[model samples]
Target: MQKKMIKKIRKRDTKGLDYVINNYSKKVYYLVDKIIGFYGREEVEECVSDVFYELWENIDQFDEKRGEFSSFIYMKTKYKALDYKRRLEKKEVHKTELEDDITNKITTEHIVLDKESSEEIIEIINNFKEPDKTYFYNRYFMYYKVDDIAVMYKTTRASVENRLYRCRLKIKEMLEGRK
Candidate 1:
C-alpha cells in the first residue's frame, strides 16, 4: 500500500499524497508529540503539515533498496521536529539576551545588595543539584520564564515552579542561618 502510494507520489499524483497523509497522519502526530510536546497543539499540527510538505518536496530522494516508506517518513518527522525545536531555542536565546539587557539596566538602578551577599547567593546556587542548579541559573541568572524552563527540560510548568520554590526556600534558610 505504502510503496504504491510512494510510487504515485513520485509520479506527482496528488491522490497518493492524500492517501499517505490519511493513512499516516496519526503516526506522524505521535512522533511529533513525543519530540516536541511542550509546544502548543497548533505548532505541533504545523510541524505535521511541514513533515508532509517535506515528503512531497523530497519524494525523489526515497530509495526502495535502502529502506521502507514508513522509515523514511519517520526519519523526516523526527528531523523536522528537531529543526523546529532548534529554531525556537535560537529565538528564545535572542529574546532572552535583549530582555536581560533592559532588565539589567533597570535592576542595577534600583537593587542594592552588598557584594558579599551577592557572592554568598551565587555560591549557594552553585551547590544545588543537577536540574535544580540548572533551573536556578535559567530562572534567576538567565531570566527565563517557568514555561520556557519546562519546555527546555521537557517537563510540566507546575513541576518547574514547585522545584524552584523548594530551591528558594532552601536558599532562604541557608541565608537566614548565616545571619
Candidate 2:
C-alpha cells in the first residue's frame, strides 16, 4: 500500500495525496492535538495541513531502507506539532528584552514615548539599507518568525537573528542619543 501510494504521489497524482490524507490525517490530527491541543482546534487543524504539505514536498527524502512509512509520518507530525506549539507558547510565554525593547527600548528601560517618538523610530528603521530595513520591519512590526524571515532572505536562521539583534542594539543606541 505504501509502495502504491508512493508511486502515485511521485507521479504528482492528487488522488495519491488524497489517499494518503484519508489514511493518515486522523493519526496526524491525533498526534498534533496531543501536542498542541490546548491552543484549540484551529491550531490542530493547521498543523495537520502543514504535516501533509511537508510530506508531499519532501517525499523524495524519505528512504524506506531507513524506516517505515508510518514511522516517517509519525515523526513528521510530531515535530511539526511541536513547532506549532512552540510558536504559540512563545507568543504568550514570556516578557523578554526582544519582546519589550524595540517593540512597541533598550535593556531594562522601555523607551516610553508619545506618537512623535514612535514615528521617529519608524523613520529610523526605514532609513536602514536593504536587508536590515527589511529584517527590522518584519521582525519588529510584522512579528514574523525568524526562521521564515531567513528563508525569505536566503540566509541562515542564525544570520537573520544576528542581524535583528544588531539592528535592535543600533536602534537602542539611537533612541538613547535622542534623550
Alpha-carbon lDDT of model 1: 0.84
Write down the lDDT of every candidate, Cα atoms only. 0.84, 0.81
- Tell me the TM-score of model 2: 0.53
Listed per model in order, the count of residue pairs whose N, CA or C atoms clash below 3 Å is 0, 1
Cα lDDT tens digits, model 2, 54-79, are 98988887898999988998999999
Flag regions of model 2 displaced more than 4 Å. Answer: 94-179
Show the colliding residue pairs in model 1: none
TM-score of each: 0.58, 0.53
Worst 10 residues of 1 by lDDT: 107-116
Q: lDDT by residue for model 1 over 1-179, one digit each (tens)?
A: 78788888989899999998998999999999988778678879999999999999999988999998889999999999999988878888879857854665354323325235577777887899989999878987787877899999999988987887787777767776886
